[model samples]
Target chain A: MTKMHMVSALNNALDIAMKADDKIVILGEDVGVDGGVFRVTENLQKNYGEQRVIDTPLAEAGIVGCSIGMSLNGLKPIPEIQFSGFSYQAFHHIKQHMARIRQRTNNTMSCPMVLRAPCSGGIRALEHHSESPESFFIHCQGIRVIMPAGPYDAKGLMLAAIKSEDPVIFLEPKKIYRSFKEDVPEEAYEIELDKANVRKQGTDLTMISWGAMTRLCEETIEDLEKENISVEHIDLRTLWPLDINTLSNSVNKTKKCIIVQEATKSCSLSSEISAQINERCVLNLEAPIQRVTSWDLPFPQFALENYFLPNKTRIKNAVKKVLEF
Target chain B: MAQEQIGQFGINHVSILDKEGNVDEKLASGFTKEQLSEMYYYMNLLRKFDEKLFNLQRSGKIGTYAQTKGQEASEIGSGLALSENDWFVPSFRELGVYLTRKVPKNLLVQAWNGDTRALGNPNHSHNLPISIPIGSQCIHATGIAWASQIKQEKDVTIVYFGEGATSEGDFHEAMNFAGVFNLPIVFFCQRNGWSISTPTTKETKSETIAQKAIAYGFKGIQVDGNDVLAVNKVTTQAIEKARSGDGPTLIESITYRMGDHTTSDDSMKYRTQEEINEWENKDPVLRFEKYITNNNILNEQEKTDIHNAIEREIQEAVEQGLSVEKPNPEQMFEDVFAQMPEMLKEQKEELLNEIIQMSEQNNNGGNQ
Candidate 1:
């Protein structure tokens, strides 16, 4: 095993999927000879031929809509919706057809495809470029949604997403594309899409999060531990179809759970999990399931970003509140 | 198909069949009596189905249905024109043609009844999901068409939409892709005059909806949609052209919505009584019936018998639709994806248990 960044991990995952299935194809705005804006798809076209790696026009609907057709025709398509925010352009296609085709068609056909979006804040990108819209997709029923927190998880989850029999939205955290490195397995291995990994186990309290938020919480847990305050950190691999068993078990042991997410707190995935915990495991709770999430406001640019995102201080305070209660 | 992909600067209408049960001998040679009769019978069935479903809506048995009254000839004729290997992609309003392609009669009723389960089978042919948002299927059709072309398959894709859909960006992008790649597709538009309350005149001021093809460097046709013969004629030529490697052809079946856009809509709100009367005179089904009967192809008795048979069959279909067990409200959770995540499964179980507990309490008749 060798350590690699998120982009390298993604490259290895594509190498794995493409090698396994000849029907697998990669398409996006600049995914062809130019590799892609982020170079995540670098060397794909060269390895697999131009027919498999297509450089589509700058039309999100065309990219996603056409891929649905291609997938229906028995070809596997991995479409890149350049930026997470840019995916909104193809929202109708995804939410309406891509997500519901299997159910609407009564399981006679499945749109087995993957939509890879480089998502979330921390990258000082364009206005719409950095946004966490996993909650929007979680509201949709038929598609699998996952946000990988690191290089290893990205490699494993992307493979699982591609191999799955249904549509999956694989959100790659742009902020962590090159932020961290870990030695991924030399032999390709798949990490399940519906399970969250235990980043650290502590008995005092549990901190649940996904994507870039997990890294911040991981850092916060380090400092929190120094003050004799221990926290259980969970890196949610998949957002929708959440690994509630793992989350509930941790909440049962710790007796308190704090969910951290980059999206606004209202009507978010965090809200769904909070409601579920209250309804399912309310008796075991010590205090209310605290949420360390973004305020319900349009994400501001760099200046006020620290005030918006859940960082070490905010998370530590939430941990302090739950402990005191 | 490439041989027929000629760049026409104006309308390229290619019709041979006429309203008076007449056909141009040159194009008629390809069709047999059996094929034409099947199309005739199917179109009749569609008209009858529309008649009964509307009545059911009035009686509150089924939900609203978009009438295919003046557009059956267009849908039936065009759908019949495609080869078996070719694809048929349609919007929600075109369920009549979708049924023609073998979407079950029960499914048609179930879908309108709010059971999306009605649209559940595709083993019959290449049909995309019924699109509620107009014109979106056009791009999917184009993509499927290109997939065939790229793979060098002897197939094509035919997309159906209304004239109002031309205004959508999806329509523009689909046409652009069809033109650029010269994909084997037919952009079959049913120009049923009215986008709900808005008339076609307000939808676009273009001289003809078919003329929009000129913007994308392809041939376009303006057909008298009420005449089944004309719809069949242009559709056959377009299908042949696409089969021979010609790019997409835009055929605008110029017709009118003879009934309300849906059961809940009031056509009187948007169109005048006089306009409705004029289009009623040009109803596609009536035009075809007049042509067939006046020519002695199908006598009055034969027409009555067919209509009676269709009505009885539709009644049976309604019974079949309603006869099923009270739908599994739990179906809302099943088949969401190929598999439910453990959490959803548990959530579903919890919901079921909660319902069971509620039912138990309600049996005591004081749970409110």
Candidate 2:
């Protein structure tokens, strides 16, 4: 095992996958020479050559639409959007073609490609560079949505997404891209998609989150444990095709739940999970389900980003509210 | 500082046959009798099939249908220029292209009937499904060609769209990518006079859609879309150039819609009878028929035989399409993912149980 950050781990996964499969290609703006804006694909072009690692023009829709075409022609292309905010430019292609090609063609043609984008805030970057838009992709059908919290799962989940037969929206938490390091496997490995990872187990309250928010939840749970409050922390690796079984089991055992997300609360994945928990384990709940998410307002500038994002204080307050209820 | 001109570019127009069936002998030469006859046959077949589909929509047998009444030559002519190894990416309203590519006639019928099975097996067909969203397929074609270029393959990709599609960002992006990569692709735009109610003048202020390619650093030409020979000749040259690594070409085929955009539209609301009459006089099928007769490629008896055969073939396809069994509702849940997730599986089970209970309730009510 090698100690690596999320960026290197993702780059290693792409390298291993490309070396193994000639049909696997990587394409996006600055992906070829510069290795992506976040350097998640560093030196991929040098290793795989320009043919496999392409530097596309500055057009988001073109990158995605071309990836769909490449997928149709027996190539597994991974196209990266510079940031999650810019993905809206390609939303039409994502919603219309990439997500529906298989169902529209009745399984005759399947789009087996992965769209990678750095998402969530905390980097103090420019505007439109740090927005969390996972909810938009989760609402789309015929596509898998995934976000890995750390280096270990980043490598594993990205490999799995590359191998998936269906289109996958792989959202990387750019905030923690290089913030921390973890011991990740050197060789190829795959984490099963559509499953949640149980980070810690307890019985008092269930703490559920994904992506960068999961790291904050971890800190919150640790602090809560010191105060004699046992919390079961779950990191949702795959957002869609959600592992509701794990969530329901945890909520049932704990008899309480609090969901956190970096994205806004309205019509979000947190809302969906909250509704699901109520439907499945409502009778077992000792308290009302709580949600700690960013406000419905647009993601604010860097000066107020910390205030906008859900922090340890907000999460701890929500935990207290659920426990008191 | 002295004034200087950086670049100079010019657009060329190609027309091998006129409305009166008079051919430019030099340009129309070298087409074998079999090839000429096949072109005539497909154009006529497309026209007849289009009429039948229009009738089907009127009789409520199918949904709203787009009629390829007068632009048959533009679609079939370019379609015929493609080799079996090449890819044919189509926008909607390319039924003639599908027919020329030899897509099963019943599959075409099934598509208009709102069935997913109409998208023929991808493993066996090089033609893509008709993209409903305007101009979206251009980037897809560019990518396919890019893939071929990467793999060092000789196959080419040809994408078809209308004049209005040129205004879309995807179209320009695709052209730019094709030019930059020197990918083997053909952008075949049929200037079919109108984009629904909007005319070409409102679509673009440019003198001709063909010149749009020059801005992207490639060659572009305008062709007489009503002249089957000209479209075929121009497309053949472009295909050859692409296969030989000369890069992409944009051919704007000048044609007319000759009918409403689809069954839901009424051209009379926006166009004049005189204009329709003018286009009717330049009908692609009649023009092609006249050319083939003048050149002795097909006699009157052979024309009659081909017409009857196409009529019977279209009728058989319609019957076959109607007779096919409806897809099971469970199929809706199957293709969304290769392996159905637990949530989808549970939902499918719930739907199935609901259906069973509804049928049981009806039976019980009948007994009561």
Best by lDDT: 2
Off by over 4 Å in 1: B1-8, B14-31, B122-125, B150-152, B293-312, B315-319, B350-368
| CAPRI docking class of candidate 1 | medium
lDDT of each residue in B45-113, candidate 1, tens digit only: 888888878888889888767777778878888877877677888886775677667766876887778
Instruction: Report how closely model 2 matches the true complex, as a DockQ value.
Output: 0.77
Candidate 2 lDDT by residue in tens digits, A215-253: 999888888889999999999999998999999999999
User: Mind giving the per-residue lDDT tens digits that candidate 2 earns over B13-61?
Assistant: 9999998888999988878888888998899999999999999999999
Q: What's model 2's lDDT at B153?
A: 89
Clashing pairs in 1: A105-B120, B1-B244, B1-B245, B1-B246, B2-B244, B2-B245, B2-B246
Whole-model lDDT for model 2 versus the true structure?
0.92
